[model samples]
Target: MKNQNFVRNLVGTAILAALVLALQLLLGSLKLGPFNITLTLVPIILGAVLYGPLSAAFLGGLFGFLVCISVISGNDAGGFMLFSQKPVITLALCMIKSTAAGYLSGLVARSLSKKNATLSLFLAAGIAPVVNTGIFILGLLLFFQDTLVLWANGQDKVIDFLLFSILGINFTTEFLVNLVLVPVLARILRNLRFVKQELAV
Candidate 1:
């Protein structure tokens, strides 16, 4: 039973990872200002709620790596050159942001499961995007503020362009996407037999 459960979780994680990758690719093509609002974190959130932190983090890291590679290869829709400017730094930030979001989602869900399953899932899904985008914004402010200010074209009044970018665009985009999709996805996943059987306990 133990081995079987492990295998099941592994397979589920792989499938979720692929789904995240596909979503990222598709969403990357669509631009809504600075936020290319994507459902990429949905799978990671689901994985975290169903499996555990490590699995969730692994899937998040995997997706982040793929995104970094895509950026490096100039496949991103924005063509912002996020990876080209500072490859290692960009990759590290992506990995850290994604993994932390995933891990936290799982931890929060697990802690809240006994009280309210729906609320737990809701929190898990909702928190991931905030964390992911928040970290990205912070990293930009810390490392790439100068470039961001130049790109702002004087429209933003904030001294730190990164801060303005987050408040102005990134947070809104992330909030809108996650708000619309997370609840729906969480409800659907809760109904799945595997999820109910393995995760609801």
Candidate 2:
């Protein structure tokens, strides 16, 4: 079982990491306005629910890596511009928030599922976007408050700036998307005997 666990973790992580990259690169841009509407969060959240926190972290890191590549390769002009201005800090923000969100989602879901799995799934799904956005907003505050304000052009107040410019529809859509997809996908995944075995292992 220990060996099974180790193999399962490795294999599962690889598969999910691939999924994250594929969805982002193959499916074309999911961006709207100043935001990149994310499609990869589903896989990260799924890994968290099915595999474990470590697997989730691995998937999240892969997601970040792909994003980094996308930016560096000049596939995303806005991302590349941001990376040009604040390379290290921007990369850190991307990786840290996503990685933490993935790990936290798995930890929360796994813990809560021991008591109430239905509630656990929703809670876990719901938490990731909040954490993701929260960390992003915090990162802006910590690393780019002046940049943000300058971009906002001093028209909007801080809270209003965050809501309108930052979170806005992208945040709502991401949250709702996760809320709907995570549970539905989890239900499908639950029927898979292999997924169950991996989880149990």
Winning model by TM-score = 2
Query: TM-scores of the models, in the given order?
Result: 0.83, 0.89
lDDT accuracy of residue 70 in candidate 2: 82
| Candidate 2 lDDT tens digits, 1-201 | 999978876886787788888898897247776557887899898888878888888888878778788877777765676778899888887788888889999999889776777777787788888888899889878777776776567746777778875688768888899889887777666676436622321
lDDT of each: 0.72, 0.79
State residue 149's C-alpha deviation in candidate 2, in Å.
2.0
Regions of candidate 2 where Cα sits further than 4 Å from its true position: 155-158, 197-201
lDDT (C-alpha) at residue 14 in model 2: 82
lDDT of 1 by residue, 1-201 (tens): 999889978887888888887888766334555545556777788888888788889978887787677666766643245566777888798789988999998899889877887778778877888888888878866876665665666536545454555555665666676656666665666676546543442
